[model samples]
Target: MLAQTNLPQVAHGAPYLSVVVPIYNEEESIPHLYTRLQEALDELAKPYEVLAIDDGSRDQSFHLLRELAQQDGRWRVVRFRRNFGQTAGFAAGFARARGEWVVTIDADLQNDPRDIRMLLAKAEEGFDVVSGWRAKRQDPFLNRRLPSQLANGLISWATGVRLHDYGCSLKVYRAAVVKQIELYGELHRFIPAIASWQGVEVAELPVNHEARKYGTSKYGIGRTTRVVLDLITVRFLLSYSTRPMQVFGAVGLLFSGLGGALLAYLAYIRLFMGSPLADRPLLLLAVLLVVLGVQLLGMGLLGELVTRVYYEGRQRPIYVVREELNIE
Candidate 1:
């Protein structure tokens, strides 16, 4: 439910490349980021557009973006009414992107814009998605680096997409491939894994990382927990998205079998030894397990119905287009 305004029609023909950047309170870094990004895009000598989605910045970020857009038509700006998170910002950009290839980068100045050429080169080699790996990340060791390392490993292991850096924001994707994916919540962190689900060719390359010179880091330790939860979502969507009943039914059966066995043992003891079931806590535990198992099975059925509704119901898209600039 993102409210968009000032959306303009796209040009007749698509550009060679579109760079989508999500800006969040980066007023201090705007000038440098714009200069470097423009320089990098200009070097390609191809038709390109920069889609700058301002994620409800509390500072003068939007004002500066407007100024840049006015100065150069290649600079397109999209401002959110309020902060909608990074994933929403990216989705907004993707919906309006009219380019053969799309590139995404952070606005903090940490990801070098010059490495974009390398990513584009790799993408030209027939890769649907090219992810950047910050091989030598220049962030705080404990707070940023360590947690990112652990998260990357866990995500790779769970999704079977072995990339060294899942946290890196610099990435390249074919416009068609990116447009097919629906980004929501924190799902942007697992773009590679999600795209791989469609059998897209995904490749990772080492990219240069720079130290932050502007605003404080927006992420914290809490994001690690959120990433773990989102990773579970990604795993479920990858394996059982079409047939959710498989996973839920399997788990429900296991629990039901365990509970049934426990209850049968309790019944045998009660009948054979004449033990009073009312005095044993095991009876209550068994009963609780059986009830929980039944509830889980019911939930699996509900999930199957929900899945059908999602695919067969209204053809609502994952993203809402508020306004687009320089897109056909």
Candidate 2:
């Protein structure tokens, strides 16, 4: 499948901050993104490196990043074999990061690079993870803003993170904290929630958000369904990961109890009141529930076995390392 790789070391020394920008087909925005990002990082007056990940862009994104990396040792580029999604890109960046703090931002220029400082400021308050909140989002009301609002609310309620902008890519985290959380699928949006599981301090701050000036948004309303599905996964990992049987067994018992009560009532009706049972729909319902309950209990047992295998099995890491650039 997909593997991670880095380039030869560029000898920029250890960076105080590592900015990871995942670029996908954003050819026109590269120049502007690089210039503004460098300007912002320069102003911070700290050792920093920009880890630009080209997520199998079909455009000149990789070429642009390569040229920039050659020109500036502080600019490191990682090219993926194919588009493995944003989560994979983040995982690669995190694996190669050698900074005390890591920052993530989109490559579309919508998230101002200058906002990186805002996140870092909040992060300095001893918060392990500092997330950006787009208090006043600049997007269409129907397609972009509405769906995002609903998704953010649902994710907060489900994960108990209570952030207004879970979709914002501008965020800051201590390198150590993020390294502890594994990335997979579309779990990048749930980084805060995942980090919360380690009992880390998480905070949110309002940041500047601008409308897109380059290509169209990669995501749309269709992604909402995927986000909901991933949220279920996150909830399971957070609550029932250590004890899968509790959730499954509890629900299974409820169904089994209801089914047993129904069957008992039907038995009483048939024996004591001389009522016909074969023609009644309640009998079928009871039988169906009982079968379904047993299947659920069996699935619960299977889930426990899988969980053990996941934790105690081969002990493989999530992302594969191909190579690293400018990293010692």
* TM-score result, candidate 2: 0.91
Show model 1 residue runs off by greater than 4 Å. Answer: 1-12, 269-273, 314-328
Candidate 1 local Cα displacement, residue 197, angstroms: 1.0
Across residues 1-328, which tens digit of lDDT does each residue of candidate 2 receive? 1122343336456889999998889888998897899789889988888888888889888877777776677888888877878998898888788899999999998888898888898888899999988888888989889999999999999999899999999999999988877788799999999888899898988888898999878888888888999999999999998788888888888888889999999999999999999899999999888888888898899999999987788645444444445445
lDDT of 1 by residue, 216-328 (tens): 88888888888999999999999998887788788878788888998999999889989888888888888887887788888889999999998788655344444544333
Question: For candidate 1, which ten residues in a row score worst on lDDT?
Answer: 1-10
Per-model clash counts, in order, read: 2, 8
lDDT of 2 at 286: 93
Q: What is the TM-score of each candidate against the true structure?
A: 0.90, 0.91
TM-score of 1: 0.90
Pairs that collide, model 2: 4-322, 5-322, 5-323, 6-323, 6-324, 7-324, 7-325, 10-326
